[model samples]
Target: MDEFAEARAALVTLEKRKQGLIAELNDVHAAIRSQRNKLEELIRRLPVSPINRLPDEILLRIFELILIFGTPRTEDKNCCVRWKGQLAEVSRQWRNVILHSPCLWTTIRVSPSWNTARIEAHIMRSSKSPLDIEISPWRNSYALKDRPLLRRLELVVPCAERWRSLTISSVVSSSTFRVLQRLDHLSLPSLTSVWIERFPCCEPGKFDLPFLQPQRAPLIEKIFISGDIGMLKGREIPSSVKTLAVESTSLRWKITSALLLEFVPCQRLTSLCLGNFTNSEELPPNSIQLPLLEKFVSRGGVSAALICAIVAPRLKHFECHELSAYPSLHDRFVAVGGKFSNVDHLELHAGPQRSQRYKPPSQSLRLAFPGRTQARFSTGNTLKA
Candidate 1:
């Protein structure tokens, strides 16, 4: 019984000793945590690198410059966002700065390869800032399937009201492009610039952009239409458009005169650029008035029909590219007694023609632009002013 009593007393003593050791362990853990925090504080207080020491405003500006200058190509839709992601991963402070800056996320690119979640994330991050959206789908074999692309596009269509600039390039058939028909009746109040390129149309017919009506897009000022010009054949350019460019990049199909004339009704245009015409068609015998046109640029084979048809009293700048086509047009202009009497500057650029030799029409420059104060003429190899 005495031995049992001794064992009980020893057990109580060991329990008390174990409690004391646990208290010491707890104190050591607290000290280690405190030291770790102190070390971090010391490191932060030390002199930072030049970039890190910069004020947040300067850093933000630098980030903006990176986005502007680092873009290697226009088609690299996700390049800027990728760079932003890398920049945010550098530190917690950077992530916070980028996350809070809504302007940094305003330029949204909706490529067919991207998922719907990323698209929604961009819209959320942009907050209420005006958006510059580029919806460019992949071409040919690399293209994503239609079902996934349609799902992604569904998220972007509702955000048209926030669009400041919209570029939609579709290389697919007309049926695939019908996905955008949902945007037809939506109001685009903040939109000022639009660029549409539709390259392939297996089911070819006129594709009207009823969304571009002046009532829907009152603030639109610039319209650049390229690729298959026939797609937008019957669509009317907004009268509020200050600049209009009708160009075709396809070497396969030349822009038709009927398609070209469709934009002639933009009477309020200040700048008109027409290009990619290989065929000269007989335009309707009607003189169109461009009362406010100040700058006129003609690229590729601009038909004499268009040259003679326009009546621009305010024209000051006249530039013609692919001057190989000019000699014939110039002769036609002379034959038709065509002249821009108010043109103050004239430019002619020469291009290669396999069948014809180019001769500088110096006399035509004087006769065609009687009021020109400056003139520049280029041969295939030389520039003369």
Candidate 2:
């Protein structure tokens, strides 16, 4: 019995000693881990490249140029992600510079492929800089429900006060239009430029925005609308608008002189471009005079009466498409020949030749300018200006 008791006591002491050694081993491992962490922190603090020697301002300028030229084109989500990754992976210093530079994040392009986390990261990094927002989808890709894009729009809509320009090139779904309608209630005081293209077919008032009201977007000075001319049919354009562009693949309805006048405020315009306007009727007796207009461009079947109605006294440059196809309009063209008397530069595009009967007589469409005007003429295969 005594020997058995003694053996049991020895076993207890051995077990205790084993536990003590295990505790000591654990302490040693913890100390090694702490030392490794310290070494890593020290290494990070050391400068390893000569590029780090550049001043912050110089680095900022370089970053600005990179962003300016490296910005992804419309619907190019992959390029945008690659650019963000490349800039962040260079080094800790570069990453820090990119994160701290608000201008680098100010231009936000959102597509359906972008994840929520990535979009939020961009918004956070952009800070308080004025934002140039572009929302579109990849070309030739299936149009799926873009939840990420919708979420991004919801996130950025609250920041509309800081928006400098907003461009929507996507096929706006019903949900998208609903969200846009909310903008009418919000104040976009800083929004100066807006461009909307390729809007999906919707009801007459579906795409209307209150921000378009001259009272709402008082600072808006430029507007560009493409795809549908119906989008501008009944809207009252602000007098503050100086530059305007309207383009369509084909007109859904005839653009009358009154409709054209409705799109432009009574004030002088700086630059005006009208493209693919197949059917334009004559203006009313009161002409639409753009006294301060410097540049004017027209394409497709624009009416001669509409051209005659525009009295741009200071017009410097004029461009138009071939007018020979409209036989009945030949006399109208001659009547308006003297309207370009002050135009110094002209470009007439003689479009694809049809039957010889449709060919315009050389002298039938002459410009009787008081001063010499440098003119360029372009046919389908040749160019003579």
Candidate 3:
């Protein structure tokens, strides 16, 4: 009996020791966890990264790359509205980066595809950045009144400081000029291309917006007109004017021809493009002796007399795209012999061998080409073909 009691006491003692060891282990684990949390808290309280100490300008530049030039999706390709809006939603510094980037903000395209309010906001947000605005309004919607759009455009583009290319279009109207006729003063110093078309200025009194002397927009490189080029005749274009493109809705030759002559005064002219001016009266005002006038294009028929004048000059190109036979037109060019002295780049826009029948413009044009040989013509379709 004594031995069994002793054995039971020994077993109880061993179990008590095991239980005490487990309790100690639990206390040790709790202490370790408490120490780990305290260490983590201390680490978090320490001073932040050395990278955060960058200067504001350097940080701003980093934001600019991420917000402006980050990805193809971020770039202002065709003025994507979603990308623009997304940029605004980024961090405040990033927003500033995008707003300051002139290239990202310069172009604002107002179209049926985008929210008009959004477009307006973009324009407003651009502040002093010179705008490259392109708006093609919906067909059915009433043409935007001059007051709503032009007024806003005027606010942004005051006197054309940095505007490079401007294209203004008006929808159909019952009035003389398809829209407002008071375009006397929008001289842009940086303007390179001006294309105004489909201007329904056919009415007699409508197109005669009394001649205002050429307000100078000196850097112009290319000019295209399809609506009434009524007021520009007789006025000397700024000498910087280069390529001239004309497409008229009028079929009358007198009107189209006269306007062509007016452009001859542009002494630096290098190219002339004519579209859909058909019929007989007087040919395109005497081909301005553009010594530099290398390329000539006519989508409609070109009279033999007109071709004769072209051959007479230092033409690098004589491109006639369409031909209609007018009897006895070739007599004068052949009679004078092919004395077209300077023509080298001859492009026939029509089917084979059309130039065989027609004669180039007169040799007399060579002498008169450099001077103010204005087109004694008139028409409204100076832009629309």
lDDT of 1 at 289: 71
Per-residue CA lDDT of model 3 for 204-301, tens digit only, reads: 43443211223445667777777655444454455676787777764332455545555455466788787766534454434435657766777776
lDDT of 2 by residue, 1-385 (tens): 9999999999999999999999999999999999999999999998767788887778878877766676656745467556767877988878888878888777777666666676677788888888887776544323545444556668778787888888877654343454455454777778888887764444456654755776668888888876655656667778888888777643465655347666687565888888776544646522887888888887764676677677887888888776454444456556666666777887766667534334334454455344435877666766665
| Every candidate's lDDT | 0.72, 0.69, 0.54
Worst 10 residues of 2 by lDDT: 353-362
User: Per-residue lDDT of 1-385 in model 1, one digit per residue for the tens?
Assistant: 9999999999999999999999999999999999999999999999888977787888888888887666777556577878889999998878888888888888776665567777888899999999988776656413444555556667877888999998877776452365455455678988999877764442234334543577888899998877665555445677788888877766544556445656556577899887776645466433667788899888875556767766788989989888555346456455334358889998877776522355555576567688888988776766778
The whole-model C-alpha lDDT of candidate 3 against the native structure comes to 0.54
Off-target runs (Cα >4 Å) in candidate 2 are 1-53, 70-81, 91-93, 137-146, 171-184, 248-253, 278-281, 284-286, 322-324, 327-333, 336-344, 353-374
How much lDDT does candidate 1 score?
0.72
Scored by lDDT, the top model is 1
Model number with the top TM-score:
1
lDDT of 3 at 252: 31
TM-score each candidate.
0.74, 0.72, 0.56
